[model samples]
Target chain A: MAQSNFDRRRINGPEESFQPTFEDDDDRETRWKPGNPRIGRGARDIRPIFLTAGLINQANGSAYIETEKTKIACAVYGPRQSKSTTYNEKGRLNVEVKFSPFSCTRRRVPIRDAEDRSVAVQIQQALVPAVRLELLPKSTIDIFITIIENDGIEGCIAAGSVAASAALADAGIEMLGLVASCSAAVVGKEIWLDPTEEEGKASSGTLILAGMPALGTITSVWQSGSMTPADGIKCMEACQERYTDIHAVIAQSLLDNAQNNT
Target chain B: MAAVLLSKSERAYIQSSLKATPPLRADGRGLLDFRTVLLETGVAPLANGSARLNIGKMAREGGGGTEIVAAAKLEVEDVESGDGVDGGRVACSVTCSPAAYPHLSSNALDELQHDLSVILQQTIGHPSLHPRNLTIIPRKKSWLLNLDAVVLADAGNVVDALFMAARAALWDAKVPRTRAVQYRAPEALKSAKNDVPGAMDVDEGTSGFDTRDMARTAADFELPDYWDEGETLDGREKWPVCVTLNLLTPRHFLDATPAEEASVPQRLHLMFSFVPSAPPTLQAMRLLGPEELDLKDLKESIAFGEQYAKELFTALETKLREEDNRRNIKARDRFALMR
Candidate 1:
């Protein structure tokens, strides 16, 4: 992985259009419904994605992504010798997640809590299948994800994977294919794609998955709460459908960088 | 990691830079121009009274390279014994955290704190405006004002920067009103005697009253009913400013930036107050350097520091008073709500 110096220059910008919400609002009875007119909609509101490649100068590769409301930064370090020698046949990947002290409304304490650790583990599980770890034996590539700001869990893990993959590619790390991740929540019988914080909280079920479109392989699978196996299959299908849009974004981010460098 | 060593030539170049300019250095201002100082109070949301000051950033002309931030925290405490007969005391501590220089020693912090304390004690605690006046209750309790100064970034001339921050923080500090409730004592109640309604005064021809007893009664019973009013009192504490003098070669600078500081061999720090309408008060003074300064240098530095100290105090007072007026207007709006 090659470290990029551009990341350090972009600090948290002036506060505007940032909203803080507590709890999810995705239940069937909730006054606000997903895709409702009250929520408003636009490419500017939902698109206008800000993406940057090669930020962490010390890391092999790094990228920062900011959607309408969410901001995620990822850095990939190494391909260096692995610390744990036991996994000698295949290379290893480790993921770490961090939130800035001022990332949230309330001061975020430095200590990593159970929730954060779980997210890190889940993210690692999601990306493992997409990365070609066996290409470099006895080596390890570390991914550090820092959530500068969070809007909603919708597309967060997928966004994180895209950032991680871009950073890894920038570092010149070999990968079987790019993995894209996204999530959907089932609130009551209704399936909501890209649930906001309010919707995610009210959701009775959540499905997070990652897959390599080129290879047609599912790299990660995660489900929480209660959802039928049929519902799970439906959500995965929806995710695959969403992948086309996410793939374009990942592709454009790299293309823009290539053009800028040229 | 091997330490990056400074060669002899590098040290000599730095020393030569110090001598390149004569007294009343390059900016054409006197030895005490003090670079344009900008002070703003109540900047820190969390602190009681926080201040951010930029000292000497103007000297860079258009470069805009140097900047410093100093914040002050003011806290109140009870007056301790042996601190005169005053019921309360105010402690002002200033910490300069230079973003440019992160690894500062504890000794440096202590030196800055001591200088600030002196300046505050002298001007704010002048003999006429005694700190004891701030005491709501005598002997038993008093308000102790604690001021903490923090330096957010270091541009140059931290002493001036620190002083500005300290002054702003002090202005921002609001000494809460202290109220005391005292129940009437049984003995005091017993001392009250009822006078007959519509009773006539005694004269020489009638029943006589002793003149000596009348005098004693007058002395003991005057305003006896409102004795409690005098028992508890509240007032504002005085404000003070810290002054630092940097000795560069044979020339003396009032506030020196980090670059200028690195060139200087010694520093003389003093905390003093001059209330223009009143006599100057000297609180604390210290000469910081490996080498000792002669009495003449000490006296000259003191004079130079005192002159700037007065100017800083006036500027701070005006700024604080303006803030107080703004607050009063807001308070009046709040009072309107009660009706």
Candidate 2:
């Protein structure tokens, strides 16, 4: 019976579905044209953050972060017994990112796609440097990220990284410092911080940078699309400034959560 | 990378030596140097294009390097009007051979495969080349290029080696030129008597019938024979090649060996596409391993990638040209024997 493929408990959608196309159906109004200025903000400005911690009582530590249209929920569990009972010198960190079926403009099935895995890998790289894994040897820490609503893929991931670190801190796990993240897109000559999906689609390049502000160290950097080296450097510099602001918000939320707990 | 283990003293020694000014690698090479690579193309005859690349395989040595093979298969299929096929489509998959790691469990291998496949698909499978090259008819039929890569050997830096093999395969690829023909059913065809596929041949050469008059619905592609007529992908020079920078504290190197990789804690994988007489543009980048990214030398690190990509592209192009000449000479000799 175990040989039977697929899970029985979950209802499976069609094996495949294609996006329907119609001639002269270009949604020009919603699409951001290239070489245009930032619609509502300056080239180097980022969206305001709405962050909260300790939202889920069931999770060891949980946090939710929202920036404009993108929303991410992160939960951290363990430093508990690992499934593999082999002797280990350092703890194992498992990071998983999933998209809700209705998170994006198009429906996402329960299946985990390549984008989800790529983000998971990026988040793992960002947080692994800060976590004090050697102290919790032979254990495992699991971080689960869920995208409830999505705008741009890079934006969701940057927000998700911040929420993940907050959740880990809320769980009372010891770490060198909290890792904060920021993302931006280069549209024509302008760099739009926290670009929406439309701007990201039309942008020349995308940069996702995450780091620890206290330690002044970058933990991860992922840049996709195409741009010259000069634009990349400028883009990274802009994201670094925004990373600190985002980290400040997380610190304030943790402060508020701490005061309320007492 | 963990297959080769070194003592603590050895690891530290390698790291410190690499940090020295004009840093030295254990293999008697400069810090930015890559191990010599032996590249061969046209390995898979059944596929449209294929390549096999062996890196760090020194002369008179018995299998002391990483080897990878990549193949691109082409299939023509009907597409809906104004559908996704406008740019044609490229699907990519990468798998690790179990033989490469007999000691590792299947789960670990699967994870590595998934990681490599995702990165490759994001960089190479995305549209960099114009799609009209593969489209035989607008909004009707197009060629689907399915690229598959296998890691035959694993010495170290398999990701870099895999991307190189994929690039070479794509470089050696030949897409059989195709002509579109529309079928006009005979006036008495309501009886559904004749269903000869695609309706005609390319040898007919658009002589008499006006293919432009037929509706798009009845159009189909006729593939060319391999005897003579075919075309290589255009603007392949603009295709990106991956360059990895292995970080060892103050110094970073390109195309690290297994021993060099174990001592290093972080790396930057950069993909770049360059054309003649213009600045090279970045395609994608990812920081791997568990360490802080070195921000001080970020600009210089990218410059290294740009320079390395230009050199590697030149090498790849020269090898492909030689292969083409050899094939042509062989063809001439074969035709001479026809007497």
Candidate 3:
């Protein structure tokens, strides 16, 4: 890792373009599919999602989630005293997300790069409203997420959100409902759900939606690049449709953890 | 840096104290008194010039010192004729350590860096610092001085400490000297200009004497060669140092620490440079923080600043001289060791 002369903390340089030789380079020539655009998978289908809670004993609550190649672990500590406490009726939520150095194809510098900070902010926006913060007045809840592996930027973020929700639940914090996120990449006119790292790079636009299924309310939505309003609504619909399946997996994981505890 | 959280009573006490006839500050200093600063030059071995500055609170105030480290490095780059003035260019960058200012969000850090850089460029970019003929060759090559300041700690009044360190580092900077050669276009070439579509047809390159054209010629036209020992920047006496005043409603305070800065709603930053032979000049002033001020109050603040700036200018001049003398003695001792 590179270090600044004045400070020992690692600082990343400009990112290099991702280019790797693949044996099936000619097979998937374009991002859009005439029939099935996905790489050996259904176009509308998502990769397998796995969730487990209470993996970290040190934290009040912890959870781990893996969505195909994207793996994230989250730890929930403190409803503890806030470091900089002021007069506030509601508890403060502090969210920080970091990626491991070898999480992606390229070796990352061990620092909170710009992208990490951005993703952390997105997560904060999504979780702040979902948590019953008024229940823990004048306190602070600290959530730290670490990505162990990342196959796509959107997929990794979605995985982080799911892990955080499960972690909060495991810690026995009150919440309206579980928050789950789904991401889709817009390639030409086609919408590909859970696009791989390569497919994401080829996308013209991307949409990520996080919502609490029980309350039928969206906590946060992020969209970038080019997408029509109709396309955005369709993407959101697709994301909402997947919430049930994600909820079932998370519930099963918690149940299994309780059974194992005995 | 985490701002000291004053209770409702503490806030009330300070506000009322500021409004009192004697106007005693929370730290018990007069409005004009600045925190004590410890400055040392040549702390960085690799840089052309460097300074480390620390502003310590009074013993009664009871806290750690705020530290700022600054370094100046000189590089050279070529420019084309017809560009502009061939003076040395100054670029500044400021970064704050996350450990020192844990309360500052990343977005706040970015904004602070931008504000400091803009002030540094505006204050140091005066043409007087780099006279028209300073470059070796017009538009060929000129000195590019980069001044970088890092705030290792943020007690209060970070901008002032950064400016003080940068001013000292700039005084210590030395730029490499160069030689220039004047070239006259051939008469036949001048005549041939009509054949070329975009060439200038007017013969009086000397006529009209547009000062802008002269500056362009100074920067882009003639070229300079570097072969001699480096030269120090001229008109050192005219270089400026910034003084910041934190305005809290009815009262104004100078050299505010982080806790003090958080309590105030507005700040006025003034750049004052002194020429020994004349009265000190207020080069520029900028108001920061999110508060509107009445025009009359702003004018009054600037007037008050002018008076204090004169005194500060004298103190800085004395300190600079003392540092220069100590650096010279160190250099002589090193030379004697070589002998």
On DockQ, the leading prediction is 2
Please state every model's RMSD to the true fold in angstroms.
Answer: 26.5, 6.3, 17.4
Q: What digit string (tens of lDDT, one per residue) describes model 1 on residues B6-114?
A: 4557556655655565543434556566667666656766655566666655544653423434343333343333332345665555444434445545654544444
lDDT of 1 by residue, A1-262 (tens): 1132224444633433333666765654747655543243421123346778878788888899887667899999988898865656668788888876666665555555433554665577666766777788999888999988876654566678778878877788877777766777666666766666666676655666576666665555555444544555567677767765676777788777768879
What tens digits encode model 3's per-residue C-alpha lDDT throughout A1-262?
3334223453545434343555665645653454545566765778898889998999999999988788899999989887774767678888899999789767677765645766776677667767888888878999999999999888887778888988988998888888887888777677888777877777655667677777766666655444444465577678778766787788888888889989
Expressed as tens digits, the lDDT of each residue in B1-339 for candidate 2 is: 434667778989989888887687778888767788888888998988889999898677667789999998887766774334754788789989999877678987888888888888878765544434777677777778888999988888898888888888887777788777766645575334345667544444355674534453646777756675377777676667888899766677888888788888888898887777677888888888888865666667777777887787778778877877767777689879996
Between candidates 2 and 3, the one scoring higher on lDDT is 2
TM-score of chain B of each: 0.61, 0.84, 0.76
Candidates ranked, most accurate by TM-score first: 2, 3, 1
Considering just the first chain, candidate 3 attains a TM-score of 0.88
**CA-lDDT, candidates in order:** 0.58, 0.82, 0.72
- Residue A95 Cα positional deviation in candidate 1, in Å, after optimal superposition: 50
For every candidate, how close is chain A to the native chain A in TM-score? 0.79, 0.91, 0.88
Which model scores highest in lDDT? 2
